[model samples]
Target: MEVFVARSHPVDTHVGNRLRQRRALLGMSQTDLGNAVGLTFQQVQKYERGFNRISSSRLFEFSKVLDVPVEHFFDGMGATAVAAKRKPGRPRAPEKPADSDLNTKRETLELVRAYYKIRSKSLREKTRDLIIALARD
Candidate 1:
């Protein structure tokens, strides 16, 4: 008998992070995402944690539910990770940016959600301008 173990790939982890990021940005709970995807919240959690790999069909469904393109999940992944999957040799370390943590912050997500909730386009633009000016200062 042969035993096999499933390991989480870096790409999978990156996809999961993107999933969580998109979900959070939409202010959707795991239960909300699960209901839309026809899965339990626990299953959603598993996917977000990279404990289970998501199928292409499942990812497509998620894209529809999350109102994002399927490419969204792979947005920030490095070329090395993609090549690593195809080559299937020793895992290469992911190249992470120093400011990567900024994008994953709860405060950043909350700010983005709040910013998008402004109904008026002019107001949104003005808010964006204000933020940019403040950031530059």
Candidate 2:
């Protein structure tokens, strides 16, 4: 008899990271997400951490709630990640450092949230233009 332990796949972690990024970008709390999905915040945290696998249906639900397409979760994944085949007893590849991605940064998310909260469309456009102009300097 063989006993198998299920390890988290890189795809799962990637999806979880995307989920966290989207949630943060929208300024939604874990509790709010959990309430929408009929889950506890702890469960949401587990999903965000890739400790629990998300089902297709649940992922669809998340897509609806997050106002993104299903493909959003899979976006930015490399071909290597998409084709990963892990063997038992083999060590997993090291994950990229959390700080490596600008999108995953707390400051980036906060800035996005604040920008959205501006309410006035023209103000938001001007704010975006200002940031872009500043970056070009």
lDDT of 1 by residue, 39-102 (tens): 9999999898777889999999999999999999999687766765533444456446323757
Please report, as a residue range, the 10-residue window in candidate 1 with the lowest summed lDDT.
86-95
- lDDT by residue for model 2 over 71-100, one digit each (tens)? 999899877679888688776767786568
Native RMSD of candidate 1 (Å): 3.8
Off by over 4 Å in 2: 1-7
- TM-score, one value per model: 0.81, 0.86
Error of 2 at 65 (Å): 1.8
Model 1 / residue 1 / CA error / Å: 20
Q: Lowest-lDDT window of 10 residues in candidate 2? A: 90-99
Model 2 TM-score relative to the real fold = 0.86
